[model samples]
Target: MSLVVTTNVAGMNSQRALSIADRQLTTSLERLSSGSRINRAADDASNLAISEGLRAQIGGFRVALRNTQDGISVLQTAEGALTETQGILHRMRDLSVQAANAGSLDDDARGNLQSEIGQLRNELDRIAGTTSFNGRKLLDGGYRTVFHVGADAGHTIAVDLGRGTSAAALGVDGIDVTGPGRYGPGAVTLSTAAAPGTAAVLTIAAAGGSAGFSGGTGGVSAYTDLDGTISVGGRSFDLASVRYDTAADTDGNGTRDAADLLAQLNRAAIVALGLTSPPFSSPTPGTLAFAVAEPLPGHTGTAGAPLSASAADLARSTPTFTAAGGASRALTAIDAAIERISTVRGDLGAVQNRLEHNIAKLGVALDNTAASDSRIRDTDMATEMTAFTRTQILSQAGTAMLAQAHAAPQGVLKLLV
Candidate 1:
């Protein structure tokens, strides 16, 4: 309040006030344009940090929703395939029941019924093995699926539907080829029978045989009545084409019998019989014996249950209606298979329902989280505009005052004059 010629302190005070008002006005304009309360760390550092965290969570939730949808799709694929398997199993069961009526279903009719039943069983195996989702095998029991449902560890949904229900897994017993094999009935005795890997000659013959070979002719052609192709363990081999010699008899002196024929059956024949060579047994003169073993190449695993077949293909097998009650056992197996398939379908349906609910929950969570984040980070347009208008008035008033203060020095000039 002093009239001094040396300094105009009033003008300097007005200039400082004007600068403060101008800076505030610019800040209000920026807030209005960006529609954000915290444009930078300086605006509201705490709230900006908090909003960032919330945004990350919202993103995670969206990803989890997508994962859930994908899981549902995969389950749907498996469910459809299992449904078809159920229908096939039901048809097989019906056929088995009909075939069981021994008097009504004669040998020929039963044979036809069994043929259809076998086809159905094979179809079941095919569906179980080949059903897939997004190139991942679903029904093969080899896939173990996991989906992350939350942003943190241990927040996942796991689905483990192990190897699907194949016909073999359903306990559908395969056909018994040639009943029980043994070293008898024209048993050809080995000169020196080695355990498993030993190769020796069939030198002697005991009577009671299907085919007799006379050493007089050097080689009596081949074994009779054993020329047809026999199927074993889902493989077929022609026994007629395979040549059997009593240790390469040079002068027709080697005594060849039915055992020699069985031992020297073709590789294909051996595989078809489902028995590995060198069956452990001392060969009688005319016969040799081997226990009937279903070539389960990889069914019974090295540790208890293996999955690989020697050929990596499940035996394409069917039951033959040869026994008196063959159909009865088949009917039981079909019933069990049906029950198992039903269980699988039920599980899929339940999971689908659960996932639908999970999606709904995710949607709710996303909406709420966005709302929370908006409250923390978004500007109130009405509030910002009001502040901007006020700052505009203050800046205009400050400019006028600053000019008046600067002119206040003119009062000193008037005193000088």
Candidate 2:
């Protein structure tokens, strides 16, 4: 090599090598400090983006799992309430059986039994109205609760817990007028109640209809869909867009003796059909008693003398349990109520099971996703430490070589001397 003082080519090469070593050492330190290889986007931009997405998914799964847990808890609350209602119903059934033994019991004894039974019915109504979860009603047929089961849109589960405790919903609110044989003597009563000069005699049955939301499925579809024409004042009201429940309607134009006619009346039941309030009678499960207008253009009766109710309209409304055979009717109503509670509990159990599975699946997914994200972004401590050692040795050697190269220029001074 030529003796050069001003231009030190060897020094320049040594400095370049040192810079490379220093850069490697710095990268190793950064990984050690952060415990991650991709500390910055520059470290691995593509992989950083991928890991970030995985992190987002993991977070969502965690929240979704919690939501599923909450849904299970809510279902449990509802199931517990139904269990208690079932006990109350069982007791009521026992009382009704005791009351039905009219041959062995006196009127006063039966009346006492009936009063207790009435209180039980009130309790049922109370449960239906008060059972709730986080302020949402459970058994009033109103809770259509939902849970998030997955980390994406449209990934959810629903709890369709309908009115399991309501007297009307359970078919327990009235008498067992589902069958003609179920009626006893005096189950129906008819008397003259007419506007001045009107001599129409009206009759009302004490037993309710056989058809209602009775089956485990609630025949809810029947209650929902009702498309029919109810003639009032010689005009009609369209029942179009009623719901899916009334599709299997077995009412209307049937023989007067047939239960179908009564059931149809029950489905298209009218509560306030009077021109004015001659009297307002609350419905009994198997019976109805109220005066309605004659529906004549100008002959509608006043409040004190409302027209006799249309027989057709009277038949359409739900029936109540009659005073004559109320005990036997109560037994039948209790049975139906018990069935409804069981059905609701079973449905809630099914939903809870599904939610448990959802939570477990979410946990597994989160674990696996974390593993994948770790592989994409986590630093290999052993491998990074090895690189740091190599760079440290290189840096020291480069410094020594730079000093030697700078000293090489002193040889040029020897030549000059």
Candidate 3:
């Protein structure tokens, strides 16, 4: 090869090789120091994008796990409150059973029991009203929420508490185990004789103004002029100048007696006014029982707003255990309330379990996603070190070669001398 001093191409080529090797060495060092292969988009653009996506997924999974935990906490709070409510309901049941022993317990004893029941009922209402999580009421019948349990959109769980645990909601608001009988004197007793169904006894007391019906008045003697109208299911029936004995002999037995009075009350016209067929019955001597046909209006106990009985009215009626058999009925109501509370607690427990599973799932997803990101974006220390060693050796060798190329022009000068 002919040698030239003006431009030593060999030196230029050696310098270019050295520059490439030095760049490789620098890159290897950066990878080793940072512990990342794709520090910049230029390192591997597509893989960098993929790694970023995986990182985002991992972040979402972490947040979802936290959300599931929070959801579980909320459910636990609600369930804990319900457990207390169940205890109260059980106690109320015991009180009702105790009050039911009318032969042994006197008015004073029964009255004390009723007082306890009232307090317990109030407590139930308070629990329903006050039970909350994160400032959201859980037992007021309006609790409905969603928990995000997954990294992807629409991966959620819904929680809804169907109804409130209040006394009114549980049909124990009007529990009164105190009275002369289960229906109470002068009270309108509503029941279904043919089948077991909803029943209510509305006590219209003389102390509330008009002279109410006498529990001792048997047959037609029980009939009296009700000064006001009795409303049932929003329909009103005028009782003015109407006497049970004077009404038509509806029993078809000819004589107008208690049965006739019941027949008149169950007349098609009255039935059309929301009174069920054969609605009235005398469960005992001188006692008037009116089977509720539909929901009754609020029992104001005033002379003008006498309401006919229905299951809905019973739910709103406060129970007085002071009357005979009143305690037995209250016991039944307490049992029902207990069952309701149990159902609510069960639902809450189920939700808690589901949330636990959700947390596990989120953890697994986060782990897998993080691993995937590591594969795409993280450098292997062993592999990177090996590459660094090779690049370092190449850099040194290229530098030496560049020096040789630069000295080659001196050989031409020696020939000239």
Over 4 Å off in model 1, which ranges? 4-6, 106-108, 172-324
Candidate 2's displacement at residue 323, Å, is 6.4
Candidate 1 per-residue lDDT, tens place, 39-117, comes to: 8999998988899999999999899899889989888888888888888878877777776666665567867876787
Question: What local lDDT score does residue 218 receive in model 2, on the 0 to 100 scale?
Answer: 24
- Compared with the true structure, all predictions reach lDDT values of 0.61, 0.63, 0.70
RMSD of 3: 11.9
**Candidate 3 structure lDDT:** 0.70
Most lDDT-accurate candidate: 3
| Top candidate by TM-score | 3
Which is the better candidate, 1 or 2, if ranked by lDDT? 2
Candidates' RMSD to native? 14.0, 12.1, 11.9
Clashes of each: 19, 29, 20
